[model samples]
Target: MSITLFRTLEMLRHVPREPRKITTSELRDRLAAANFDVTLRTIQRDLQKLSTVFPLISDERDHVFGWSWSRDAQVETLPGMDAATAITFAMAEEYLRDMLPSGVLELLAPHFDQARRVLDATDNGLNTWKRKVRVLPRSQPLIAPDVDPEIAQSVYDALLNDRRLKAVYRPRGREPREYDLSPQGLAFRDAVTYLVASHRDYDNVLMFALHRFLHADVTDEPARHLPGFDFDEWVQRGGFDADRHGEAIQLVAQFDMAVGDHLHETPIADDQHLARTDDDRLELIANVKDTHQLRWWLRGFGPDVEVIEPAEIRDWLIEGARQQISRYADASSGR
Candidate 1:
């Protein structure tokens, strides 16, 4: 292709769908970055000419003129949206809409729209795959807490650009405080979104609930990385666990045979061994991290499971049961 064709095509790609737009200056800079090195006046002239043939519009209402593809434009690419790519984008829209940053999702709006159109138009059996499959959460779903859109965008930008954040954070049951945070990563657990970050000059990292930020602003200061911090490794070691004890423990528990049957297919740990005892009870032995999650899982089994080896865990369960019994006894007396 000629230089003109390439520049025009690159410029078109930078033009966002209506409501989101690119100024002539922004287009010129983007083109320069892409090695097109075009002038702002040239971009303006090209846009004016292209508007006659393509569904392009200029927003003259703004002080700085902005250009965009019309909201209902039917512009097609050289390589059209195929069935496979269409379905992948469709699935991303369905599953990842909540997890992705709002700004990123907005940028993908056009592709998502085209994906839906392609899937709806296809007569092949492949389009039916979306209807046949479903992803169910392992735990009961709760409504996600609402994070302020602008704050979320700021947090995302800081993390993406390796910059610091000035934030007013309110911890549960505590007064709101201001902090300069170095955002390391974002974690989405169940319905909550957390920003894994370190407070100014603090070596230790903490997870801040995104919804608890009263205010947030990205700063120009460069974010400092902890000497040996790896977000993935920290998460794997149960960093998010409320009662992490820093070491793995040998978990030995006994369960009623019928209730523990699922362990045969879905063991808690790779080293987990489940066997039937003479009394027809299920005995399980495994090496696993002793985290609050483990305790919660065991407690969820109630009378069906018993912690055998770890005296501390066994005592914990017994104390919990005793407290429950006492509470029930008092309630019965009142009745």
Candidate 2:
């Protein structure tokens, strides 16, 4: 019997028993009524298969025939995911190509293939999906640092087993630091991967870029599932306004109308608030952690973009502009 037939039997097994015992003819008619196009014999074979796994009964006195499961019985059931879920899965597959860790896709490939087969067998042709939908990753890909697969695998294993790790991390322009850390989780962000972990040396949780890791080894050290260290909360804390100093800061900036239009088209913050002034200038406010990255971004706009808030940022930009002007002054003076 087809997987669909098996699924139909499984679904029928859950339906509450009626007063009357449903006969094979009645069951066949029900299947036909639902456009199953299968015979009673096939359904009977399916029922027999289910009987081996579940508690199936036919009562002559009540003239009732149905299947039921005990409360303690572990039902090994597949998800009854609809066509929308399948389409969504297919769409997600495109993003998974580069975003997910390597080898993960291969593990899921067989399941996708099985789903396609089941969809094909349905014969109703209800699984038609738009093949035109595409996701074009940014043309200018972010510079991804080389991550050792063995180290990444080790980190993954530690997170999976709820174990600790000894990580030797080398921050940019800084000496390497070795630490014993509890592997909380791994995440992909800003076109790079990071480990959200808790260091034994530090009382607070930290985000360590995986690329910056010089070496990592799984330790027999037991992981301390700390109090109030929620992974989701920790990840959300790394949002736009999160700070390098771990303090939330407001970032405000103004741009010319033309530059404002570009910013509107491509937002810099996930939750940026944009407003248009009476003079047609665009004002943007966001919560940001690292102003250094934002400074570099605004610099690309030349004089069109201005930092309106955070006196330190404004002063830094002014000094940078002065250095640029000094360079042009010497060129113009031919001295």
Candidate 3:
């Protein structure tokens, strides 16, 4: 290859090697940050053409299409990155990228470059171990929602520096209003990002969507804090899944053989018990915290599980089914 073509290939190789799933916009921005000066159009074209030769694949799974490599293609390539640090960043970026500080990707450009080299190494080591790993949510994968970058950046900046933000928050189905909020943290749940913040005068916390901010301005004053702010504690007790824990309830259900077998492999709770029924179905009884997640879990096994006790939960499910039936009552049936 010509010297310039060789350089192009060398740079492009790092993308699949770091094993990042990045959009064309992200790739172009990263290339620009690294001084490549490649245009977005050219980069898109290059990815398209290179896919025919390399293991590269374009994933349109979410709203933002990302270009990544086919992990199963075991082509021996060079690894130019450290095995440990690269894996940490790779996992973080993949799982929590939506919730990270807005300028993180830009700041992490150089590290990603080095990581790509290490991950691409042919040596059978931890650097290449990501190829054998996969992390997926139990819920059916939904397309990712969009967040405005500028709004997210200002929020991150204020939080990182302990400053406050003057933001316009438009809660769902409500009028847009402005408020001075002290940024606390960010939460990612079911593919959406929630900005955890508190008003200047009170210690009570409120959540605002990153995309809901029509306007944001970083203020000069330092943020005031409550006595103790533990992100995990706040999340577990009071954040997004608002009713994460409450009155514990006894849950008993009968499951079909398939759902029952899967539950045996991964019990929902430690105290769960499985007893054989006369009809060959699996009967399960467990004490679980009343939470939205539990309901969602049971819904996934629709037609395979039935609530056997706790008339309240049974009534809840029946009412839900009736509501759904009412919704479809006016609609025609599928052939």
Candidate 4:
């Protein structure tokens, strides 16, 4: 067949596969939007022709006929879709949407159909579960970093195949720098995927943002095997925590009645103790890691909370508040 005729037949298959019903005009519009350049009459005629063998149907009772697959049609003819795999794809389509490469999702499109059919048949509203559940960040929400398809695929390929990679990594506004490394592990946290990898010449493990990879390629060399690498331990050691600064210290703070009321449900730590004072304030003490995240948390409570110790942290907060107050004062004076 000619390429044009082949593409026409391809477009014919897509018309009825939309998630919802479509009129011939709507189908033509979809084709146009997809850069198919087909006419509405052509779509109607193709639908009429394909209806003989396909499970295609049209609502003739309506003033304007709308087309879709037959309600009772089984998607079994499409591909391999066992009940288990179908449900798995249904869940993966949502949960792994941000985790996996887009190419993988496209490769699993047939299974998504299987998932859709199984979900629709079950009728227990499992298909709509995406709307019912939400995974929110503990901090203020922010837009997730955009990941490139080919770059992500290459990263996964290297990590999964236990191969080394040459990557051009750019940090913040810095210029891109090239390096050769072995990917140790992959982690997803707060809408960002990180690559825990080590330098080719050293034992140091550094994390790379998947989105920040300008280029990456799987190399022939095998990845360096680190015998005692543990992702959880690395995380607990604040490998991924940007706020980890200074040594761990005993964090002591005082909270007003309002802040104390809030902390009743969310104590600073498991071993934290709150003692009431004469002025109805509560003093809290906990042995915690001296991280900026803790400082930021206390500062967020504004006047309701006060940092008492270590003296260094309290001094840091005092300096920060002074800077903020001066900045505001300057802004008010039209600086």
| TM-scores of the candidates in the order shown | 0.79, 0.54, 0.65, 0.64
Candidate 2 per-residue lDDT, tens place, 176-224, comes to 9997999877778656777878889465777787767878887667777
Cα lDDT tens digits, model 4, 1-335, are 68567656556555443223567876776677767787777788877887897778877776877887664454554355655566667777776666554544544565677677776766565657646766543577544577765677678878988999999999878999998989988887656788999987688788898888898888879999877887677766667665563366788888887757766788778888888988889988888887666677877877787888999888888898899999999999995
Off by over 4 Å in 2: 1-86, 100-130, 136-139, 143-150, 167-179, 211-221, 227-243, 246-252, 261-279, 285-300, 322-335
lDDT of each: 0.86, 0.67, 0.72, 0.74
138-233: candidate 3 lDDT, tens digit per residue: 566654456555576678778888888999888899999989999888776665677788987788788887777888988778987867877778
On a 0 to 100 scale, what is the lDDT of residue 241 in model 2? 32
**Number of the predicted model whose lDDT against the real structure is largest:** 1
Positional deviation of residue 240's Cα in model 4 after best superposition, in angstroms: 3.0
Please give the lDDT score for candidate 2.
Answer: 0.67
Model 4 ranges with Cα > 4 A deviation = 1-117, 125-138, 241-246, 260-262
* Clash counts for the predictions, in order: 0, 6, 8, 0
Misplaced by over 4 Å in model 3 are 1-81, 91-110, 121-128, 227-231, 241-245, 333-335
What TM-score does candidate 2 reach?
0.54
Please write out the lDDT profile of model 1 over residues 1-335, one tens digit for every residue: 89999999999988867755779998888888899887888888999999999999999996978998887786476799999999998888877666654544665677888888898999998789788877676666666677776677689879998999999999999999999999999998766789999999999998899889999988879998998999889888888984564468998999999989999999999989988988889999999988887898899899999899788889999999999999999999999
Model 4: pairs clashing at backbone N, Cα or C within 3 Å: none
The Cα error of candidate 2 at residue 319, in Å, is 3.3
TM-score of 3: 0.65
